[model samples]
Target: MAKSLKSPPADLTRISTRNGGTFPLARISKVISGEAQLPGGHGNREMPVWGPFFSRVDADQDLGRMRVDSLARYLRKIQQP
Candidate 1:
C-alpha cells in the first residue's frame, strides 16, 4: 500500500522518545507486532503505545516487559523541580 498522508503509519517507524529506556527500534517492533504485554495480563488487549519503558532484571524475572507503570516510576525518579 502507498503511504497515506491522512493517518500515521500502521507500523512504528521511529521512536521520538525513549523515556529512559534502551533499543528504541526493538521496543517499537515489539509493540507494533502486538507482542508487548505483562506476564499474566489480559489476552488480545494489546494496543500500540508511545514512549514505552522496560526493565533489565534477572533471568527468572520479567526481563523485557513493556508497561506504562514502568514509565510512571521512571518519570517520578527523574522528576525536576
Candidate 2:
C-alpha cells in the first residue's frame, strides 16, 4: 500500500480500467462517502473501505468523520503543487 501511494500515476484525473482502481486523492471526500465508483462495480480501491472501517473502530459517527477527514487532509497536504 505504501509503495502504491508513493508512486501513483502522474495523471490523477484519468481512471484506469485495467486495475479497477481510482485515485481518490483528488476527491477524497467523495471516496469517503462511497460516492465514487470504479469499473465492474468495485467500490473505491481502499480495501475494508475507510468509512465503514472507521465507523466500526469506534461506532461513533463524529469520530468516524474525524478519522476520514484527517486522512483526506493528509492526502491533500501531500499532493504535488
Candidate 3:
C-alpha cells in the first residue's frame, strides 16, 4: 500500500519557519528529487535522504515521483499567506 500524503505537523512547520525554511516550489521540487540539498544542511546530518528513502519504500521511480510531487504540493499549500 502507498503512504498517504499529509501536511507536516504544526510544530515542525513552526520550527522550520523559526529556522529560515521558506523555499519556493522549484527549490522544494529539487529537494524532493534529491537534486538539491535542503536549506541549512541539518537534514543531511539528522534525517534520511527522502529521495532514496521514498524510492526504497516502493522501488518505483514513477511512484516515487508521484509521492514526492504530492508532498511538495502539500508543503506549498501550507505556506503562510
Per-model CA lDDT versus the true structure: 0.39, 0.54, 0.60
Q: For candidate 1, write residues 41-63 as lDDT tens digits.
A: 45444344432323323342353
- Which candidate tops lDDT? 3
Cα deviation of 13 in candidate 1 (Å)?
Answer: 11
Sort by TM-score, top down from the best: 3, 2, 1
Clashing pairs in 1: none
The residue pairs that clash in candidate 3, if any, are none
What overall lDDT, based on C-alpha atoms, would model 3 receive against the true structure? 0.60
| Candidate order (lDDT) | 3, 2, 1
TM-score of 3: 0.57
Stretches off by above 4 angstroms in model 1 are 1-18, 21-23, 38-81
The alpha-carbon root-mean-square deviation between model 3 and the true structure, to one decimal in Å, is 7.5
Candidates 1 and 2: which is better by TM-score? 2
Which lDDT tens digits does candidate 3 get at residues 16-68? 36547654666666676777865556433333357767777776877877777
